[model samples]
Target chain A: MNTLLDFLRKYNYFFVFILLEAVSFVLLFRFNNYQGSIYLTGANAISAKIGGLYNEGVAFVGLRNRNKELTERNIILEHQNNTLRETLARLGHVETTTEHNVREVLRDFNLIPATVVSNSAERINNYLVIDKGENQGVRPEMGVIGGGGVVGIVYLTGKNHSLVIPVTNRKSSISCRIRGGNYFGSLQWDGKSFLRAYLDDIPRYADVKPGATIETSGYSAVFPPGIFVGRVLSVGNSKDGQSYRLEVQLGTNFSSLRDVEVISTPYKVDIDALLDSAKVKDEADQLNGLGL
Target chain B: MFQTILSRIFWILLLTFLQVVIFNHVHILGYATPLPYIYALLILPSNTPRWLYILIGFCLGLCIDTFTNTPGIAAAATTASGLVVPWFLVAFGPKDLGDDDTLRPNHHTMKWGPFLRYAFCAVTLQCTLFFTIEAFSFFAPLDLLFNILGSIVLTMIFIVILELIRNER
Candidate 1:
């Protein structure tokens, strides 16, 4: 015991270093595949509160520009809605069947508006904290979309804040496909540019073109189909050359992401159950995969 | 003594705030994000206890990581730097191994040259490890090398400017 005490007295600091590093490595690997621990992530109350106040201050700085962008987006969406409504009226010969619009009929989902309190893009695995959480029905695995397009899925949720696995993260993979093409592939970030990602496992025989619009494939319950993902930038052969790897320009501007709309799927309970089931979970990638 | 601890805590909070609010958002050419929170770790009094240094470094990096959502990556990197600092001091710092408890790494205590060397080594070690851990599961080695080097230079510039200001004060 005395010898142990003496050794500790001499090497306590080294022991502390080792212990702390060990803890860090454990935490690193534990939540590596996904954000597993809420306390360690940005969704924790203290960091979220700080980030919330800070982003609120920053949001004040960009108020006018944000407003302008929203106004422009509103104008475009309104125009598209008008065109869709006219097309509906022309086809069905009824002014409207109900308050439910054509787009709402396509998918029974609600957009839970949320403000981004913290966002990072320079890092390899980036995440964002938004100001809505469990109290506001923000839960893990819900789809999040920004002003431009698809942002990411909500990873964890606190009482009043939630953490998001943003599109810029290396581990972020979303089921997506070319708008008109039947072939599909997963959209994944390559830890480089915030504006770009790679479409994985796209076969070489599939007809892909530069500037082709990519959209969510709706193979999973996280996000509905046809949400704008990005535009194809270039097509190249994968490292093994068995598949076509296409460079894609992501729709959302990750660096400047300020606002997002969390998608609330109507049958979340059913979706979550299916996602959690053993039989379904076995082919989780197929449920989340694009083509293969 | 109480006042010094209080002031150090204050500086840590301030640096953490700056890193979370401003530096995290500032991406230079979409790659380099100057982590100013590292200043808090680098500026701790050189005579600081090894256990305390390691603990504080872990908490400091973990604090920034919590806000950034990288979890243990930051904590591990900063703890590694904390472990190597005293040794680095032994090499480049003034020869006062017996009385290191009071001499801080500030320009006021050590000459600017040794101080800068300490800062460069500590910052390089921390940033290199941080980027390596972040890129371990992904990214090519060449890309990882570029990431480490680019971040080190950027973080060095920020730390130097901060050190200069700390010097003047």
Candidate 2:
């Protein structure tokens, strides 16, 4: 016992080093288990507080550019509104039930405006911290869209801040389809460039052109259909040759994303609850059928 | 002793702010990001207690991780680098330095050659460990290599510039 004590006393630093490293690795792996701890992330109150102050300064620096972009958007929106009004006047006598129902479905979603407090794009697993959180009606799995297009999905929500997993991240995958095309595929980041992503499971026979637009398929409850995702840069065969992988130029520039809207759909919560219960029942049914 | 500890804490907080707020947002060529927060761990006084050294490193890393939303990537890499720093000091630092020496590392103390070599090795070790843990997979080995190499070079340039400015002062 005395000799062991002596040994420990002599090499106590080694033990301390190992213990500290073990703690760090534990925190790392535990948090990497996918939304394990929001408090440990940038969305935490303290970090967000500091980030808010820093962002105020940064936001000031880019005010001119932001103004220019907003003006351009305003002009485009005005032109679109005029065209839409003319179309509405033309279709007044022949209003379709499908068009009315689509408008009603869109009304179920509310957009909560939020400012990005902290964001990065260089890392393989990039994250964004936004000012909106649970208190502001933001929730995990809700889609976030910037002025240009789809930004990301809320991964975790703190009280006043939320962590967003941008489309550039490896873990981010969205169901997408070519505009005016029936074929659907999953859009995933290639981990090489923030400007580009890949749409997988597109059959080789599909006429995927370089300039075709890709948008959300609305197959999942996360994002509504027809939201712009990206444009196809090139089409290539998947490694297995069973499907074609189209390289897509992402619509949202993540590096400069400042303002975003979180899609808050009350119907999504109901759908998720229903699906979860169905999953549980399915598991139970399988066990009972197997005599477990 | 109290004053020294307070000053050390202040320096750590300052460096953490610079790293989390400014350097974390920088993505030169969409790849390289300067991580000079490890500069704090690299310049620890020669006589700092080994346990304290490791703790400081871990806390510094954890603080940056928290602000950057990396959780444990920085903490783990910095701790591993801290584990090797003492041995590295003995190997690459000035030969005449004794345990009683509380001198902080600088080019003047260790000479330009040893200081540069030490910074390069330490920065490479930390950057490589960080990117490896971050990627956590061999699927994009090329991307991983570019990130590690780009970060190392960027971090080295920042460290050298910081040292030069300090020398001027």
Candidate 3:
């Protein structure tokens, strides 16, 4: 017993090392699936505090540029607001009886503001860290967007912080379609340039012109339809000559993304459940149809 | 002993902050991300027990892992470094090497040829391990190699500058 105790004492540090490593491995592997996003929340809280401090120091340095951006955005919003008002006026005022119905329709989509705490553009699989987590209604598979357009999808959510697998990450692919065309392709980052990505599965017959706009297809629950993704910069036929590969310029300037908005749809859960039930019903129908 | 503990804590915090704030921001060659913070683990006192050194290295790495949200990466790299640091010290023993040799912070005093080789080996091992674990999957081997080489060269340059500053002080 004494010898065993002595042996254990001699290698205690090794035991500690193994224990710590085991803990880290578990965290890494189980991070995304874990229901508790407290770590992300804490990280978001800390990052928000740090970002506040950083903004104070650098605010003056970028004052002119920020003012210009604000003015541009304000003008765009004013135009959109005017257009919307005109459309509403043409339709005439809704009856008081329809007020509740309109409110229910408008509640389908919501935009939650968030701040980017850490942004990486250099790595092959770049990830964006945001200061919004599950506590703030951010969750995995939710779409994120910025000033320009679609940014990425939420990969993992912590309590206060969330990690985004940006459009620039090679591992990320978003289903997108060209404007005014039914043809759709998968947008994938080639892991080379920040401004560019590749569009795959585009058939050769699809009319893809340089400078054509690409937008989200709404096929995925993560993003809504018509969110700007990119513009085609170049097109090349595949080596086998069966399909065309498109090089696209990303809409968002990921290098300078400071603030982002998470899009939450209230109908998402209900829609998903309905679709799942429909699939089961269809499967049951198929079985009955096959039976003699 | 108190001083040693305090310095260890101070250096770990300082190095980790410096890594996140300054070095992580600098992209000298578009791919290079120098990790001089690993030097905090690399330059421990020689007399520290081998097992203790590994434990300290592991903790230092875990601290970094927590901050970066990259689990197990720094821990594995640092543990390997700690295990091999003793051999590196022995292989490159200075003429006047002693217990004080471990305590000295000056990396510039060594002859240029020897210093370069030692720095190369130390930084290379750390970079290789770090990038290997970070890439994890074999799909991006070219990218991993590019990152490792670029980061090692940049880290070596930074280490040399740091050594020069230490010597001047």
Q: For each prediction, how big is the interface RMSD?
A: 3.9, 3.7, 5.2
- DockQ per candidate: 0.32, 0.25, 0.15
Q: What is the DockQ of candidate 2?
A: 0.25
Candidate 2 per-residue lDDT over residues B72-168, each given as its tens digit: 8899899888888877777888787666767678899889899988988899999999988887767799988999999999999999987887567
- Model 2, position A21: C-alpha lDDT score: 83
Binned by DockQ into CAPRI classes (incorrect, acceptable, medium, high), candidate 2 is: acceptable
- Candidate 2 chain B: worst-modelled 10 consecutive residues by lDDT: B94-103
Q: Which stretches of candidate 1 lie over 4 Å from their true place?
A: A34-292, B96-101
Candidate 3 CAPRI assessment class = incorrect
- Backbone clash pairs for candidate 3 read A37-A158, A37-A159, A40-A158, A40-A159, A40-A160, A40-A161, A41-A159, A41-A160
lDDT against the true structure, each candidate: 0.82, 0.85, 0.78
Residue A33 of model 2 has an lDDT of: 62
Residues A71-95, candidate 1: write the lDDT tens digits. Answer: 9999999999999986775467432
Q: Residues B2-105, candidate 3: write the lDDT tens digits.
A: 89778777877888887777887887667778978767755566667778777777777777777776777777777777667656756664667765546443
TM-score per model over all chains: 0.43, 0.43, 0.39
Q: Chain A TM-score for each candidate, in the given order?
A: 0.59, 0.62, 0.59
Compose the digit string of candidate 1's lDDT tens values, residues B57-149. Answer: 898888887888888988998898888877877677778646525666777677888888887888788878898788763538877777777
Q: Could you give candidate 3's per-residue lDDT for residues A217-260 as a string of tens digits?
A: 88887777777787999998766888988999987899988767
**Whole-model alpha-carbon lDDT for candidate 1:** 0.82
Write out the backbone clash pairs for model 2: none
